[model samples]
Target: MNLESPKVNVTKSPQEVFNFLEDIKNFKSLMPENISKFEVLDDDKFLFALKGMPEIVLKKKEVIPPNKIVLGAAGGKLDFSLIGNIVETADGNSEVQLEFAGDFNPMMAMMIKGPITKFIETLATNMPKAI
Candidate 1:
């Protein structure tokens, strides 16, 4: 399954946004308020639990400075990738886009689509505030 989040216009420059996202632990700031059992395992990984969901570990997978960052599930039941794309706007600010892709069976996709979509949308919408 593939999901795209709304573009967010942030006051930070592209490089600044990239720098923030390069640290996997920063993701905790973007998580929904109800998240519990959060832990920062290392500079490149973190674990958190969402309501009704199994604990999840997110790890940094790849980073292209000032452009993109990719994170994936680490030792979790879900196999998924979360990508952050940063573009420099003409006004010296940045526009960030978030995308999520998950590997799941047809039945599983049907079961989780709504929640996953909302999750990614929330992440994208709240990122600028987090930064």
Candidate 2:
């Protein structure tokens, strides 16, 4: 299923915002309670464990610093992709668009949709603060 996640407007510049959001070590601090731990194994890869949600061992599929980051993973029959976009506003502020899409296992999909959405919203709102 395709999900439209929240987009948050941050006061920081695009580069600042992007750096904060892309750093995996900061993820647990930015994300909501649902995300218990988010760890970065490298510059472009990470492993995340979610409480009461479908856990993902994500690998960076693409990265174009200060602008876009995409992570992908396979869970059983499901293929998941998460796209994070950081845009520089006209006023030089930053805006983040987080999109999560995947074909998921029936049971796991149903269980994770809401939590995942919450995760995105939390990330959008707190990423700038974390920076």
Please write out the lDDT profile of model 1 over residues 39-86, one tens digit for every residue: 999989988888888888888999999999999999857799989999
Write the residue-wise lDDT of candidate 2 on 18-130 in tens digits. 67756656666766765666777776667777776555677778878889888787344458888888889999998888889887778978987987777777767776677
What stretches of model 2 exceed 4 Å from their correct place?
Answer: 74-77, 105-108
**Candidate 2 lDDT for residue 116:** 74
All candidates' TM-scores? 0.95, 0.79
The window of 10 residues in a row where model 2 has the poorest summed lDDT is 71-80
Q: Judged by lDDT, which candidate is best?
A: 1
Stretches of model 1 off by over 4 angstroms after superposition: none
lDDT of 1: 0.89
